[model samples]
Target: MSPTLSPSPFGTAKTLVLKVGSAVLTNADGDLDKGMLRTIADWTSERMAAGCNVILVTSGAVAAGRSALGVRDRNLTISQKQALAAVGQSRLMQIYAELFATHGFHVGQMLLTAGDMEDRRRYVNARYTLEELLRRRCIPIINENDTVTVDELKFGDNDGLAARVAVKMQADALVLLSDVDGVFSANPKTTPDARLIEVIEKVTPALIEQLCPTSQTGSLVGSGGMLSKLRAARLATSAGTHVAIANGKRPGILSNLVAGKFVGTYFPPAPTHRSQRTQWILHGRVSGTRQVVVDDGARDALLHRHKSLLPAGILRVVGTFKAGDLVDIVDSAGRLLGRGIVNYSSAEMDLIRGHRSADIAKILGAKPYDEAIHRDNLALFEEVTSAR
Candidate 1:
């Protein structure tokens, strides 16, 4: 029986980012699935003809390269995986180039690491490059730079990478093509009664608990699972980009999905905020240098008054860090207010803590900026919590 296709909210998106996992692009025997790749390319070309911009974020190089190298080891070392990625990235892009070209569409490959997106200058450069590609009528096929990525610089999975790309390009929607049809109330394979959730308005903790019990393990060929997809959904939605998680194995799935036909789980966008810096501050995985606690008055001034974080409001600085590092801003009760880039080093902040902004010169002997965290660089937690 054909699964029922309902209206999708993605019908209106002008620019879309579509991500396909390793499992979707690989066969059970672990070779690249040429048929599936062709289908996706065809659909993407058609979408482009209809005046919609499409960026394809894909994962399969490691799986494909490993197969070509005749390595059957399930657990390969980081170096081995990197070797596979180095080898397979080219082969994968070759296939994409050939297939997309067959349909009269050009493809541009972009390899990136999480660090590239975290750095402000690199982030801007990437965004401009993608925009220019789209303007030139070329589809940008992106993948993680797995060959050189280490733990600190890794996005861990393409799910998070796709979300960041969507936000960076100001895409209207993000489509995640995976092995599953959608997010089920329970594991569909183990539980016959598991219900497929059609639309998710919010990724609440309760919903996560109900759908994801233990962390979901990906298919034999992919690293991303349900948990990573959910995290991606949260990030994309928070940035006002709608997201859809659907079965990639289905024929013409991308076309059907954007045609207002229900395919997989859909996550609606949050309130639109055009501030890209704010989105970066909210979702960028730059490890914070320290925790800065503020009193209720400071919290109100930051949130309601839309003011910069002044030294007067800082209660304390918790750790050692240099200037220009990310820091967490919390309230007296330990509630997370948001995150921002601090202008002063932890040592300097310690000296200026609780002092008025005017006294910064007297204390640190030099002040780069009056605000501890400028309003432009600050982002508030999107979740609503009662004032303590």
Candidate 2:
């Protein structure tokens, strides 16, 4: 649904997952945005008064660390970044506590790693903790655990994290507050004819290929780009959560979206929600013991037809895995297609690559099934990315 400057766009959202990117939290000078932080605290309190529950996912700890340590270089190594996050997280929370406390509300901190959301038990525990925090009229402020998260554990940006939280919490809406206004056909700064796409009913790979090539990852202070936000939208909207991407730098942008003022790009939720297992399979760290590389035909079948992955489409397997383990499916170009449980071991798949499904028994002398990965066990992203 498109908002026409009316209050109906997000007016009915009882619980909202709001993510503030580093672009809004860190100033151009790489310092904390004092004024913006204060404004958001007040805005959040006001929303609560009107009976809206908000789960705030934020980014800025590393930037805060940079400011405290007086380091301006953006090329810091993984270890350096972790060290800075360790120092800055405390300061960031302190500032937030003071700001929110002034409004007669308390705040709770939640530092999460990719593993927290990927594991079922940890995910449920996190949700229960958040529920209690909100029940006590406190805001839950969440951030990725950057201090010890390196390599595959890192979220790279908070956009994906917010979407995962929104899905897990079954939030009514999600607002991504960033520096940009919304999604566009191309880079508006460079393309004279680029136009804003106000309503995105569904995010598709074709749309991504058309609009995302020129998207810059982020400014020095932020880690996500237009493509990242779009990918996040694809994940959330597919799982029955509404989403909006707006310019947080603009005054009252969040309120405008909440009030249905039509200030950003909006995506309506899917007609039906996917099963919990589907959500778990689709939205994790995008991990598997290995990535199963597929031919173009196989990628098409999995993505477009929702068909089973067959031995005919297999190209090469990138990692080792036992049967019944999740494995990433990628095209030859290394773009992520999806992930699913593999019926055959990595060694078995390597032997059967590029062969017909009917020949599986002849080649291996044992055929568990004709399909390598069944459609029921696979989940494909509507938009493709080089994320993993």
Candidate 3:
């Protein structure tokens, strides 16, 4: 029997990260909605005054920049989008500053990339900075370092970043403010009969499959869609942080969520808490290019058997990566199994693939470990064995 779903306890949330998306922050004309921004700031400040630590993860820089530049090309070049982010980030921060100042709140801008989270030292530094900001009673407004991130190092969407931040800060809850009311049985825009899913007890493979086939498209200005929010929720929930997806335009949405009002789709955290290292291993947001493919036997051993991946199980090494680098573990059919720190470099993996563990030293004259990925360094998801 399946466990019953329950609403997340937002009222009990002491540390919160509110992620406001670009679609909700911008008007139909792609201009930043100053009024809505101010409203959110007022709500956030009220919470902070009540002794709650609120960190905001916002997305509207590109949209704001496009409006500021009067450029209408929706399909922008990589460099063009970076340029837009560079110009619009300053404008967005200025607006946040002015609006937050109205409520006597000081906002500090924090831009981060996925690479920063991968590096243990940098991750610690970033965490300390955020802690210091909260200690000083300053709200940290985080966004992707869009100006400098290339395709290789980008977090892709602020939703993913917000989830990572929530885990890093050990936040009690993550509220994603979107244009929609909440997650529905289907895409509400497409399915007229779609019903809202008020509570999600678990983020499973089946749930994700039901979301949408249509690429999770965002506002005319944003890159993320509803799917991204669900992904973020999964990341946070694994770390025992509750999550909510609600409409940013809804009146008093922020306060209402904190009041435990039914304003959005709430996802409860997992019963067992995941360690910080495990969270990073599972949801470090490793790109597709870094995935490694293994055989069905390897997949079974890792999932049902709970054993480490041996060299003989590796079917194919997908990308260039060194030992200690995080890589996705996928099956022969390219379905993602999980993610882990690779024990062997890609070049070395190629030489040892499909070879017996005992043959490792014979082939390369060096064998760092018997397992290609040790169980200690690995984190598995439900998708590892879920029906494709």
Task: Specify the poorest-scoring 10-residue window by lDDT in model 2.
Answer: 379-388
The regions of model 2 sitting more than 4 angstroms off are 5-7, 151-155, 293-316, 322-324, 329-338, 342-376, 380-388
Name the lDDT of candidate 1.
0.83
lDDT of 3 by residue, 254-362 (tens): 7677667755788888988779988888877564488779998988888888899999998888889888899998888877788999989999999999999999999
lDDT values for all models? 0.83, 0.82, 0.83
**How do the predictions measure up, each by TM-score?**
0.89, 0.81, 0.89
Model 3 earns a TM-score of 0.89
Model 1 lDDT-worst window of ten: 1-10
Q: Report the number of backbone clashes for model 3.
A: 0
Clashes of each: 1, 0, 0
Error of 3 at 115 (Å): 2.0
Instruction: Give lDDT tens digits, candidate 2, residues 132-153.
Output: 9999999999998988778522
Winner by TM-score between candidate 3 and candidate 2: 3
**Superposing all C-alpha atoms, what RMSD in Å does each candidate have to the true structure?**
2.9, 4.7, 3.5
